[model samples]
Target: MSSSRRVRPLTALALAASAVGTLLVTAPTASAGDYAGACIRSVGSRTSPNGWLIPARNFQAGSSGTCVREIQFDIAATIGLDPADAPGFIDGAFGPKTDRYVREFQSRSHLEPDGIVGPRTWEALISRTTD
Candidate 1:
């Protein structure tokens, strides 16, 4: 019945649109591994005090100083290989050598021939530790 009441709906719609726009702008089209660049995403999970599990993404190599060497160690461990046998050092840079290891791991895991380490590759790597 008043100006404030009339503007409430408009304000709500504006806020909703703004939020959606923000999410769209911030969200990556694909996960970090989607790009062939030297960056990858590392996800971690920890139990909260409330007994709820929370999964977190450690966005490494993209504005984050994640060393490729560290990621390679995890990937190697994930694929049931020793880092010493891998072609790359535990450096944080993702280079040709790392790609070679990724390819080998993919073949061993029976995944597609893509060297990109997507969610599936990550899952396989995690499974290795569990098994």
Candidate 2:
């Protein structure tokens, strides 16, 4: 014996619509406090000086640059991690400490627990700054 399953056109449409609705309902939305009062500094002509622009490449362990420095500062500030306690804080180096903090932040934000600082993580960090 063979079993066959068939979906009516109306049922298919309803299922698609329901899926879309669910996505819309569960989608994350930035709140007023997210980016309204966030202070992102500008570096010359760079549109995103504070590393707001998603980098061409993912920032992982060992990545170092001005953008990395900006990301470090933002992540530290977002997670309320004091930079004063640590020497060379926000030094633009993605080290173990930074990875740990990033993971912690990601966990808190319900993001993937990967240590790489990508666009989604950056958005979550940048948009969550308090005035």
Candidate 3:
């Protein structure tokens, strides 16, 4: 009924709006570190927490071993490639189908589509998985 009463409600409304704005502005968005996917591992390497090393040797079709399997798992999981349909499906063997998926992931990730997983590719894959 008085000027002070009216001002108090307006001030309260303004404070509420400001608080909401602040929250919206400060809200965290998805980042490279936010990826908590199952494929991510800590290999204790200097490169990434995701474990897959920047390969001393490139991994391409015909490569095989645990590292290859890890790469296949990361790439497939990152790109949402169905494991059931993924050739090898973490079998640790790099085959033609795995090569194709790697190339697809590379192209999407703005990397060279050589189907080879090197340091750069491993970094990109790790970054993407976190995203």
Candidate 4:
């Protein structure tokens, strides 16, 4: 096999090993625009084509910003929360409502259901969200 082919698997492994937080000074992704309390993460490309915006640290009930918005969108989508009915579902605020939904998503995915969107939750959410 060519060197590039050998590198691809290693690149994927490194990407998976990447932690939840790494500061990226560039602009945030499209789906998740800059927001108050937003965390600039380098979990993925800044271009943003409908993926989770994981933060530089664990996000819980008090976090808000681009990362939270991505989480809200993914979790709500996977858990079947209608945006019209639950406005907070994707409000970009990690409030009580979002935390509740996170736990639900986690439980369904067989995670710890801690309501904390760390590396495990991020991976699970990203894999589960096909849309």
* Candidate number achieving the greatest TM-score relative to the actual structure: 4
For candidate 3, report its TM-score: 0.55
Report the lDDT tens digits of candidate 2 across residue range 36-118.
22322322222233556444446778987665676667676777675553667666688888888889889999989898877
In angstroms, give how far residue 125 of model 1 lies from its true place: 1.0
Instruction: Looking at model 1, report the run of 10 residues with the lowest lDDT sum.
Output: 55-64
Query: What's the TM-score of each model vs. the native?
Result: 0.43, 0.54, 0.55, 0.57
| Stretch of 10 with least lDDT, candidate 3 | 35-44
Give lDDT for model 4.
Answer: 0.68
Task: Please give the RMSD to the true structure for each candidate, in Å.
Answer: 13.2, 16.7, 12.3, 15.6
**Local error of candidate 2 at 116, Å?**
0.8
Measured on C-alpha atoms, candidate 1 has an lDDT of 0.53
Where does candidate 3 stray beyond 4 Å?
Answer: 1-53, 82-84
Model-by-model lDDT, in order?
0.53, 0.67, 0.68, 0.68
Clash pairs (backbone) in predicted model 4:
21-56
lDDT of 3 by residue, 1-131 (tens): 65664458889999999999999999886333432221234223445335644444567898886567667767767886764665546676788778888999999889889988877788887666643
Model 1, range 1-131, lDDT digits (tens) per residue? 65564558889999999999999999875322332133333445543334433223322232223434444666655654554655544555666666777778779889874666555555655455432
Q: On a 0 to 1 TM-score scale, where does candidate 1 land against the true structure?
A: 0.43
